[model samples]
Target: MKKLALYLGLVILMFLTSCSSSKKMSSVMKTYEVETMGVGNDGTYLIKVTDYFRTSDEMVYLDGLKRDAVHCVIYSGIPAGNGSINQPALMNADTKIEGYEQALNEFFEQKEYLNFINSVVNSSKTITRLKDSKEYRISAVISVNKDELRKYLIDKKIIKSLDFIF
Candidate 1:
């Protein structure tokens, strides 16, 4: 009986802690919600993807570059109005876009910007399209590895290397 009571108290404390932390964090960061729509050959291997950025951030362009509000995309082939028979693809941010590498490097390299996106990405939920058969309809906030993200951006030349000389 004592053990059971102790375990229940611990569980309640953990639950309250998590709920409060999430609420507090949400209040601190500006929220950006993304709903993805994608097209490609057969919708199996997406050739083009559209990430709709829903945020309070000003979507503007300055200094000859795009505003950091949302990301623009480029596609390998024209959307055939419907998926092709090529093969099915997963609905992920894996498609290659025009100038995306450069944009990603410029945008996510900054600590503040990275943190902003990190918060957004980790907090925002993933929605799916019913028309796409392979869609997973996963609607949950997920966290990511910053180191892996940085390395991927660097490898794709979206950002500069950290190597420096005195």
Candidate 2:
């Protein structure tokens, strides 16, 4: 029937769009730089995250920076610098995030990352336009509640508990 064929076409189109969007999100997640600034009180970390964006909108830029900060803590870990030692990623580098894709997508989409952010030093913010491009390079030092984030990930079963032994 024509109706059945149309429904199938729509379903397939939606599936393809969703797949592409997920891939785009994951790729973007891997594209930020994090530098350890210092350790904050109560298991928190103060780090500077830098990322490029096509828009200069304040809200979008801030959100992107926050997301990058959390993503780095979760996946890439912060490099040693500014009197802070290296911190390993909560998730192992060899671990593929695809298994936890849905949970992470929801975590980010629902703005749950905001919960782990203690503060953003707006005075430390810097923005510069890339040469001959529309993209802006933005950087800021943010305080993240690393302990709380790790506990949440463990509770969600996205990562193992601190006592898990190989």
Candidate 3:
């Protein structure tokens, strides 16, 4: 009986913690909303992705051993009024676009954040760019292809045709 009570209490505490964390995140985001300049000619969009992580995690990632941090994947596709659009941009681009190489420089030339990481996909070429400010202690590399994004967008009606040419 005592064990059962303890288990219930733990579950309740976990539920409340998760709920409060989400609410706290909302408030933090309100204060630090992403700044979007606009989309590029090839449907590539630029926005700063920010997250509010636990202070402990922030200290570890921002001050510890994470020097060359990889980046996270795209969270949502582009948006239009009254609805969402499949205006997806791949993180990996095989064709480099002018005025877009700034991301690479930006990636290397930034610091003094809770945590900052910029991803570059310049092996073949690149048309998309992204920089992330995470409040969590997570590491990853997200590779994507334009063809795959197009197929998914078309199949899901995010775009009209594969060559819709955003």
Candidate 4:
């Protein structure tokens, strides 16, 4: 009877552990929110992105935020807000393109996205600590060269050229 009870307790403990791990994984995979802050001169878009991360390092935090902003612009359109019109995503998320994932992985892993970022307004950075968690919610406004990024993608054949529809 004692052995059976011990086994049952062990099973419950394992279940609880699994549940917590899954929660952590889900949070890590969660998407950050991006909104349009304004438009910049010379085909640039000013966007605000909010993201949560466990690290408190400023450089790491800023890098993640910048990457998220570019990701949102390419895959998830920046929502219309703060006197800016809605900007549609450059690549259709629903569309499946062969080699696109490989190209995207290389683009980010190689930090190629940095080329399109005009600047990150350090003065606009905001950080908020989450209650009962080590995670911090950080937000920043960044200027991205939209036209240049689009042209780059087209050149890499990751996205179709504007003249393709002609």
Q: Which candidate has the highest lDDT of all?
A: 2
Q: Mind sharing the TM-score for model 1?
A: 0.23
Could you tell me how far off, in angstroms, the CA of residue 124 lies in candidate 1 after the best superposition?
26
The CA lDDT of each predicted structure is 0.34, 0.86, 0.35, 0.84
Q: What lDDT tens digits, residue by residue, belong to model 3 across residues 34-106?
A: 3233343242333333323344343443332222211222223333322323343333333223443344345
RMSD of 1: 14.3
Candidate 1 lDDT trough over 10 residues, lowest sum: 60-69
Sort every candidate by lDDT, greatest first: 2, 4, 3, 1
- TM-score of every candidate: 0.23, 0.78, 0.24, 0.79
Q: What is the lDDT of residue 52 in candidate 3?
A: 33
Q: Report the number of the highest-TM-score candidate.
A: 4
Can you give the lDDT of residue 47 in candidate 1?
23
Worst 10 residues of 2 by lDDT: 22-31
**Residue pairs in steric clash, candidate 1?**
42-84, 44-88, 44-89, 74-98, 105-158
Task: Give the poorly placed runs of model 3, Cα more than 4 Å off.
Answer: 1-32, 55-150, 155-166
Q: Residue 45 of candidate 2: its Cα lDDT? A: 89
| Deviation in Å, model 4, residue 155 alpha carbon | 0.6
